[model samples]
Target: MNSKIQNDIKELVEEQVISKEIAASIENYYKSKKGDTPNRLFTVFAVLGSTLVGLGIILILAHNWDSFSRSIKTVFAFTPLIIGQLIVGYTIIKKKNITWREASGVFLFFAVGSSIALVSQIYNIPGNFSSYMLTWVLLCAPLIYLLKSNALAILHIVFVTSYACSFGYFNGNNTPWMYLVLLAVMMPYYYQLLKNKKIHNITSIFNWLIPLSAVIVLGTFVKKSEELGFLMYVILFGLLYNIGKIPFFDNQKLRRNGYLILGSLGTIYMLLLTSFEWLWKDILRHEIIINSQEFYVSVVLLLVTLGVLIFSYSKKRIQNFNLFQYVFVMFTIIFFLGVSGSIISIILINLLTLILGVMAIKIGADKFHFGILNYGLLIITALIVCRFFDTNMSFVLRGLLFVSVGVGFFLTNYMMLKKQKGKIE
Candidate 1:
């Protein structure tokens, strides 16, 4: 009797015949609810709105160009900038709800500033481009603080960096001090972005841009001599090493990608430096231009060396001594030894490459599959074989050297790969 009553209850429930209204209520109760959809439409509208406003401003400027006197045009250029400052000031004071109007106003300010600078140049105004750029950046800097405007702040930073790279780099006026100043200027805004945790995308953009700019500007001053260039690489890699030591759990993507990009590029650059004979040849053949005092170079080198030592000691991690850092320090010490002019440095360099290449392959094989270190080893092996088998050598000897190096490379790499597979299995 109990089984029969239970079966009947199951049949009734499965039929869903507890009246149409109750059945509908039960279905609704179990149905999953969805939250609001993403606002892609707003994003599209914002992009379109900015484009139209930019075009409208350009059109107005074009139409007025012929009729307006030079002074009037100049006044017109600054008028937008002045208005932008007022709008930003008002936004700061009121702390009102953000609206499209305020955003558009800030965007216009950027457009107006750029237009003024560009138009002034087009008319061949007798003003310096650097000075104008400096002024514009200074004016925009306060907007970042006063209105808490990330967009304006980033725009200013990018413009300043671009200007510095163009003028300072090409003109041979770039200095470490200049890079330090630019970094300083951007630091406060960087701090604010971190504190608020807003505008993360913008913050990421500046983080990459600022460091890259520093590298480019600093590189110009660094390439004065082979020794100095080697010193610069040491500093560059030291910076990379410090960056890699950051706690990865906080931002794995940023930390890993940053190290990879900077380290890879720095390594390739140092490799090219190692391979080229021009740097050493130039130093040996000609008197080095000593426009600056030796103290300058010594000071820069000391600071970079101290930075590396401090970080290495503080971290106490073996991995901190990466390929770039090791090569940089080795090159610096070798160059300072006054033996770079000898033919022996070439042999020594090649030998170093072979050893490091083998070590890299061995270490990488332990961590990753596919013998990832084979590429570096292959490059070094090729260089050694080519150097030993040049036309200056007898044919039989050249053939033997090539075969020996080639066989060694194949055997070592194959063993590494085989060991990796065994571990994985």
Candidate 2:
């Protein structure tokens, strides 16, 4: 039962808007529906408690390592894993509710990692951290489904992101292709979370984590023609934005719609940063290998983004996409326009920035939302700040430009608030 609804019911009855009997009946109905749902706070603490226990156990065993015999060390190494398994087994067999399942699953997840490390250390296993991370991730992947644990799912995303960094960035490896496969395997669970529509907080966390993990690991896919990865990132953000606009997520609040937030911000960041002449100059000067892995990856991402947009159009998820959604498509055209066209592309980028900023302001004003309105101002401010370094305009001129924008911010927000306040009155 939602506490907000319950409070409203209680107040209604007290105010004679609803009879006491009707309030009791409403409360009973809701309690019957949601009584089994675990308290979200308890769920968080349970997972945290299990994590601390797992860490404390590891610390205790490490403290006595020198004194233990080989057999004792082996036993100690497996102890936590065994205990975690028992707890999980009990939960499954007894059909324990979400709290126990989450706690046990989290404990087992850490236990698996700890056990792997301890055995490797004791037996002198020769493997890099990347390999260990991969092994741990593969081993713990099953626990996510077995325990039906969102906490474990979140942990899986974190580890896979770490694995991508370890392998792709530090290991002299090119692309961690397995990262995609690992990421793909988790999608079904995410889909189920959305389909169920219960435990919204967990669903929201996954929403945020999934895109954020992709954003973090995206750089790992970049190789030669590495500048092309910027194009790939914008398309990826476009895809995320499109997905966020799908019916299920489109109805949610901006705070809950992680894909849209990340996509919008990411598109802005990439577009602004690439608005510089230096990047365009570098692109023109460099020899981009058409056959490079990065090039192919960019192509794949573009195709997929286009495909998603088409699907969205067919489904009527959006009658029209925001200007931010088109950035990726426009960026590609500019990306290919090399040579002396760099100047033209730079001009186009600046225009796109200005147009997007203006559009945001208009949308914010129309929606009468202070957040959206301020976000538009923020974009314009960022653009001006970027121009601060890139232009030869005199200090006095730039100062005036900044001052004008500052005044626009104040006036726009002031007018919006006045409108809102008058409407309220």
Candidate 3:
């Protein structure tokens, strides 16, 4: 049984917050579960301990590395790999539990990379850093399935992102197209994890990781019309925003819903970036090449975002119809206008940002969510700060605007708390 659940209701009843009958029902519900979520520390420390041991072995070997003969070095190289394999194999057959599986998978993962690096060093193998990361990721990806380890899955995504960075950045003409395939291969496992109907810590991690990986790697696809890359990003974020509205993800806690968080934040950030007058001024200098690769990617992204919006509509996932969900659609028109050297687009964006913040405050108040309300206040503050330098507005007016917004923040929060107290009484 979960110890925290037991303690919580016992305390609640003592405080006269709930009757004994309700407490008993709550206790029975949890006690009837086949398995509760594992204690967080157990899995974390298990994986951490195995990783430290693996590093220690490597460090010790490096100390005596040059003193040994080629045969001795070769033996040392394979020792950890062999031991890790045996442990993982045993885990699969008998000691199949979260601690054993994650520890073994992580240990074997590091072993595979170390062994490969050692072999390359001893044999003087010729390879770049990107190629090595690719090989390492490819070899360890199966560990995600073989051991059914979420820790391994998260590590796999990290390594995959690192590989993209190595292969795509400043390297001559090397596109990391294989990254999409690698990420796709891991989706089946993610789908299965979600279908389990429990929000494990690991579930929340993948929630953030998958989108983060894509957002990081998406920049690698920029070959032409470099400025349009920003547009592609906005559209991708919009797609992510729509994806968040899906029932499976929306019903989860805010921390677990990475698509919504990242999507909303990313959109706001891009909006802030675009609101600058100089950006559009620069875009006017360069030719808006519709024939460029970035343009094509942006088109695909817009279509996909639109498709998701329509699908979400059919399913009726968003209950309140968030205005920011259509931010992509709105920005598409704004972007074209900006590129055409229209000043109206920038003004519209400022208005949009202000409206978004206001809507956020309203939503937060309705939900009694202090965090959401504050986030909305921050959004407006960000916009005002962005506009501070660009316009010819005087210092007095700007200072007045700042003072007004600051006062609004305090009053809104105070009212919200007072209302919540009234409801409680």
TM-score against truth, every candidate: 0.68, 0.94, 0.91
Q: Would you give me the overall lDDT of model 1?
A: 0.57
Q: What tens-digit string does per-residue lDDT give for candidate 3 at 1-425?
A: 67887898899999999999999988777776636656568889999999999999999999989999999998999999999999999999995788899999999999999999999999999998889988999998888998889889888899999999889885666779889888987999999999894487678888999998889988988876888887889899999988987888888888899999999999999999888989888763366798987888899999999999888877876577798899999988888887777789889889998999999999899999999999999999999999998889999999999999999999999999999999999
Query: What is candidate 2's lDDT per residue for 1-425, written digit by digit as tens?
Result: 78899899989988999899999999999988777667889988999999999999999988989998878888888999999999999999999999999999999999999999989888988999989999999998988888888888999999999999999999995688889989888888888999896347779888899999999999998866777787788888988887787777878887889998899899889889888888777664466778888888888888988998888888877775488777889888877764335567778878888888888888888879788888888998998899899889999999999999989999999999999899899
C-alpha lDDT (0 to 100) for residue 27 of candidate 2: 91
Off by over 4 Å in 3: 1-40
Q: Which residue pairs does candidate 2 place in steric collision?
A: none
The full ranking of all candidates by lDDT, starting with the best, is: 3, 2, 1
Q: Model 2: runs farther than 4 Å from truth?
A: 1-23, 339-341
| Per-residue lDDT value at 335 in model 2 | 70
What is candidate 3's TM-score against the reference?
0.91
Clashing pairs in 3: none
Global lDDT of each candidate: 0.57, 0.87, 0.89
lDDT of 2 at 390: 85
Candidate 3 at residue 226, lDDT? Answer: 83
Write model 1 residue lDDT over 140-170, tens digit each, in one string. 5665555555556656667777667655665
